[model samples]
Target: AQSVTQLDSQVPVFEEAPVELRCNYSSSVSVYLFWYVQYPNQGLQLLLKYLSGSTLVESINGFEAEFNKSQTSFHLRKPSVHISDTAEYFCAVTSKTSYDTVIFGPGTSLSVIP
Candidate 1:
C-alpha cells in the first residue's frame, strides 16, 4: 500500500517571497514521484517528477524538490514566488505495479499576497 501526507495544509506568503510545501510518503515498494499544481477550477499539471535518476528534480517554472529515500520524504521549495503562483499543490505517488491510480495527499494551498 502507498500513502502520502502533506505536512502543511496552507502556506501564506507575500509576493516575491520564498515558500516551501512539505510532503512525505510511505510505500511498500518502488514508486514514481510527482508534484502537480492546480489553478482555480482547472486540472492539475505536472510540475516535476523523480522516476529513477538524480535525487533532485525541478519544474520548468523555478520550483524544485528532492526525493529522500532514507527519510521517505519529498518536499517542494521555491526561491521566489508571484501572485500567479497562488494555487493548490499536491504531492502524489504511483507504484510501479499500479500505474493506473495515483495516491495524493491532502494538499497544500499556497496563497501569494501582493
Candidate 2:
C-alpha cells in the first residue's frame, strides 16, 4: 500500500514570498507523485506531477516539485506566491500497479496574505 503525508496543515505567507510545502510518502512498490490544489468551493486541480523521466517536474503556474526516490519525498515549492494562490493543497500518490487508485494526504491549507 502507498500513503501520502503532508507535514504542515496550514501555511501562512505574505504575497510574493517563497514557500515550500513538504510531502512525504511510503510505498512498497514504485509510484507516481502528484500535487493538487483546490480553490474555495472548487474541485481539485492538478498542480504538478512526477511520473517518469526527470526527477524534477514543474507546473505552468510557477510551482515545481522534485521527486527524491531515496528520501521518498516530493516537496512542492514556489519562488513567489500570490494572493490568488491561497487554497487547499493535497499531496497524492498512486502505485504503478493501480494508476486509477490514488491516495491523498490530509491536505495543506495555504493562506497567502496581501
**Clashes (candidate 1):** 0
Q: Cα deviation of 9 in candidate 2 (Å)? A: 0.2
lDDT of 1: 0.94
Candidate 2 wrong stretches, greater than 4 Å: none
Please, what are the lDDT tens digits per residue for candidate 2 over residues 1-114? Answer: 788999999999999999999999999999989999999999999999999999999999899999999999999999999999999999999988844699999999999999
Estimate TM-scores for all models.
0.95, 0.97
Q: Where's the lowest-lDDT run of ten residues in candidate 2?
A: 93-102
Pick by TM-score: which candidate is best? Answer: 2
Query: Model 1 Cα displacement at 55 (Å)?
Result: 0.8
Q: Each candidate: what lDDT?
A: 0.94, 0.95
Model 1: lDDT of residue 92: 98
